[model samples]
Target: MPVSASYRWSPFCVDGVTTVAVKTLKENAAEVEKKDLLSELEVMKSLDPHVNVVRFLGCCTDKDPIFVIIEYVNRGKLQTYLRNSRAERHYGNTHGKSNILTSGDLTSFMYQVAKGMDYLTSRGIIHRDLAARNILITDDHTCKVADFGFARDVVTSKIYERKSEGKLPIRWMATESLYDNIFSVKSDIWSFGILMWEIVTLGSTPYPGISAADVMRKVRDGYRLEKPEHCRRELYNIMYYCWSSDSNERPTFLEVVQMLDKLLHTEMDYIELERFPDHNYYNIVNLSGEKL
Candidate 1:
């Protein structure tokens, strides 16, 4: 199958068990971001591979069309799943479904993501872009952080300085990054908050209809995206803490994992009810394993 989109790349099935997504940096392509792609490759190479990270199998650089070979995820992007979930919740009949992600499923996914980030952090790598779109899921319902296209090696001082010079996703960026273009492990925590929000909100657009500049302004002015009605207060509070203006105030990735663990393991009747209103909500069903 060939993935279709206007994002300047296509995914093709390589074999029954494997597929490859090729991101080409061609001379004739319009607005080629060669540096960005190369930087991503460099970052991916530096970090040790983990199951929670999309594996970098190989690349094709000698040919005219430079391409990076990566492990293909059969399930596609996390954002796609979120959008589907949102649609099901809003319009579809979700009774007796078996594959839908419940709060527990989300917690498991978050833990996996955190484990991946923790591994990256231990290796002194920072995923500069940590958004729903950048995360990919597998056939077995495992979550992996992908799209190192924006990642940077933390050990390189010059790269760190350059990365700190701005370059952030406005809506998902931490407040400190918005103002100073500075990112440390702490700023990543802020991004994690946004990621958590995305998972819970079923991939709703962050700061919807707002310009990047305006998002920065509002964030600086102590504004944050409102929690959805179904969002748990504890989870929302955790997200709020992650968005704290002071980068130092944000929790570490391990801390985030612990918090999430607590939330997932401890059965808080109120929070559970608030997060999932009806029995039908938790039973929305995940149809990913079935053949489409």
Candidate 2:
């Protein structure tokens, strides 16, 4: 599914009906070479089943390339789906994507994401990468958090900081995270804000017209993206709160879930779900339908 230019993973359906995905590494010393891989495998294997979270099937770390098997979400990335839906509507090409997510659909999907993140943060797990593209959708309109390629479990009560050098999604990063390389549930909350924007805008690029190198400066200068034109005022208020300069000012995922629940105006906990692939198959597209 993903490669190690910056990541590694594989998603395929063995039977063409039941889908499965995996993360593999040279079995030789995978546990040693990439200790994170082992930790990730453990996280995957240990996750308690949840409606909003991706399901882990099994893993094989004993061989040359260790294998981490997980339930394959057929609809693929959320960003691509949004983009395609917008495009199909624009061009009137109602083939694979005709029905876009309604307000209720958006609310439910975001609530699911919040629930998944709350589960992880409650356990002190940090998803270093949190973005719409990392989220997957099933055929039945279920949103499942996917792609732990950059996830980590916080072993310390203190902040988790790294000194490594690599490219990162600057637009989606919190100010402290970009400057200090410190990651926490707070940083994740900041990312959740950006993710909400994505969902609201139907996959609009964050900080459009800004270069990645300059995003830090702009954000530092208090330049947050304005509310999406069609976004509800109440939801936009939540986004604003999420982008608070102070990490402590950001709401926890649990709080987010509660807020969304109130907005959704429902006490219902879960819904019936079924799995089906998105109509945008074979063209693994991005926010703009560009081939990945």
Candidate 3:
């Protein structure tokens, strides 16, 4: 679960058998936001039982409290792992700390996330909030896309009105979402591109030291997040293509999956491996010894 920094909700394990996160609207905002929250909950109910997406166990709406129960992923949020890896890298370079995962581990994680997205998109559902903190990993390092609080039915018309807009994290939102006020499966693709960048950079903040407005301006000018030093050219190409200025230029989730699948299978040259010396090919090996 994400840290309770500015979050109003708190996560707790339930009955020693499940982990559930509860988000309580502020008293003043509850009356106004209840409908939207309920809408999301209903959508969750409709999409339950998918292995890639988080399960909605049940909910509670009583006199003074409202809560939704979800599957408990014990390994915590993907952001936690990314942050830990980044810290380890920093310390490892300066003080000889060990690395948690190499580049190959990152690649496997990305492949799993793409598979999850492909599954959701196939079901006609788009995960509007596809951020690092929203993805949960298992203790064995398998990924599940969680936090569907912002997800919506893809075919629903006018589900979000301009006036009803709340503050978006901005950085994670697509260019069309930020500028054209248009959102579609393509918008989710944009978020996925940023997510890929996060995986490569180990959860480095997008547009670091830049304001959201500036990011919008830069995106409008065709600027995108830069590729990290350790990233492969093929991977960078994929990310760049995903964030193309024209949404139509971006590949479909299925296409994204195919491209990543290909890259994951391609063998790296000795120079390539040495350039990313910390990367371990074994990290991509599944428990059964098959390539992921």
Q: List the candidates' TM-scores in order.
A: 0.81, 0.83, 0.81
What is residue 228's positional error in candidate 1, in angstroms? 2.6
Instruction: Give lDDT for model 1.
Output: 0.69
Of the candidates shown, which would achieve the greatest TM-score relative to the real structure? 2
Q: Across residues 112-208, which tens digit of lDDT does each residue of candidate 1 receive?
A: 8888888888778777678777889887878898877657777655234334232346667776666767667777778888888777766656765
Off by over 4 Å in 1: 1-7, 13-17, 30-32, 93-98, 156-159, 162-168, 268-292
Candidate 2 lDDT (Cα, 0 to 1): 0.73
Number of the predicted model whose lDDT against the real structure is largest: 2
Residues 1-292, candidate 3: write the lDDT tens digits: 6432222556677778565766655666545466656766777877747666777778887755567677777777887787776567545656555546766677777778888888777666767778787888877778888766667776555223234465565777777778777777788888989888777766666776566668889988888887666676788898898898788999988898898887777675211322442332112111221101
Q: lDDT scores for all predictions?
A: 0.69, 0.73, 0.69
- Positional deviation of 16 in candidate 1, in angstroms? 5.7
- Separately for all candidates shown, the number of backbone clashes (residues 3 or more apart, or on different chains) is 5, 6, 0
Q: For residues 67-90, could you state the per-residue lDDT of candidate 2 as single tens digits? A: 778877778788788777666545
**In candidate 2, residue 4 scores what lDDT?**
40
